[model samples]
Target chain A: GIQVEQSPPDLILQEGANSTLRCNFSDSVNNLQWFHQNPWGQLINLFYIPSGTKQNGRLSATTVATERYSLLYISSSQTTDSGVYFCAVEPRDSSYKLIFGSGTRLLVRP
Target chain B: GAGVSQSPSNKVTEKGKDVELRCDPISGHTALYWYRQSLGQGLEFLIYFQGNSAPDKSGLPSDRFSAERTGGSVSTLTIQRTQQEDSAVYLCASSPLAGGIQYFGAGTRLSVL
Candidate 1:
């Protein structure tokens, strides 16, 4: 089984601040996705960057497949951003399954 | 629906009872998946369906857990003889293909007593 570890298990930031979250996996992956679980428990797909960089609004993610790690950046965060951010990966086995990291719990205070 | 839709946002059942949770994936999506998230924990993969057939069910926790897809659209996860450990948020997600971006629905919160 592949292992996925996320750094800064818990994070608290003042509104308008910036933060970075990292995810490291133990094996090569074919797919990597970042998700935001909001207060309502809604899992919102933030990015599907198996590799490379992408940005949406105040959120951006970059994945270095060769390095077996990915980074997510949130700039000028808002109160609504208070939630858990997850990073999941699908290994090369092609089993159509995702193994998720423990997640970085983020709390943005206004 | 515009996105993945799951029914019975919350369910409370006694132990030894059976419960069924429903999920309707986004139209035209070929891959559907079920996951469980225990309190203060990350998501755990349970099963996946490509069309009406499930190719991999290795993630199911026990024989009491089962799931089925119909018409390649709706999926139902049934848990028979539920236990307290089964109390968790069950989430459903859909992807356009086998290994594509997956969008999730608001999960169903299950509580067994």
Candidate 2:
């Protein structure tokens, strides 16, 4: 059922500013993740990038999986990095299940 | 606990009564998942164990829902007669195979009044 489109669903920065959350998946995926539902929900497991770059510290990710998209980069931003920022995948028949998107609701403001 | 250990973080059943959510994986995990987040939506795909056998329950959201997993490392998600949209937040994850990288827990906020 692959179809996860997450973009500027909502965001508002200030802390240090620097955001760029985007995940677009409609097909081809072996497993690509980037979660961080903090603010209590606790899904935190940022970046699993199914391809290419990856960083942690200030958070960083980038998966191009043949243009299926995946990018979550929240640099200097703090305030506990706000919340909501999901982007899951596992397409390609999806056995172990994982298909979430409709997220990206930052809001950092110290 | 080394991660992925959900239990009664919160639950309040009533509607039809019959709730049982538990999960504890992460000791040589063999893939286990079950998600469901409602309030703001996103994250719903409720079932997939690979040790005690459960080949993608295909997001259980019917038949009053059900789940299993025994000696392979605990897992139970039963919602027999519950309603009220079944409340929400019931996540539980673990992965050490079958498309690894999953580790989550700190969920289980049923509440079906």
Best by lDDT: 1
Q: Count the backbone clashes (under 3 Å) in each candidate.
A: 0, 0
Model 1 C-alpha lDDT per residue in residues A1-110, reported as the tens digit of each score: 99999998999999999999999999999999999999899999899999999999999999999999999999999999999999999989858799999999999998
lDDT agreement with native, every candidate: 0.94, 0.86
Give the Å error, residue B1, model 2.
40
Task: Judging by TM-score against the true structure, name the best candidate.
Answer: 1
Q: Candidate 1, residue A17: CA error in Å?
A: 0.9
DockQ score, prediction 2: 0.31
B6-94 per-residue lDDT for model 1 (tens digits): 98999999999999999999999999999999966668999999875645798899999999998888999999999999999999999
Model 1 stretches astray by more than 4 angstroms: none
What is the TM-score (0 to 1) of chain A in model 1?
0.98
Give the TM-score of chain A, superposed on the true chain A, for all candidates in the order listed: 0.98, 0.34
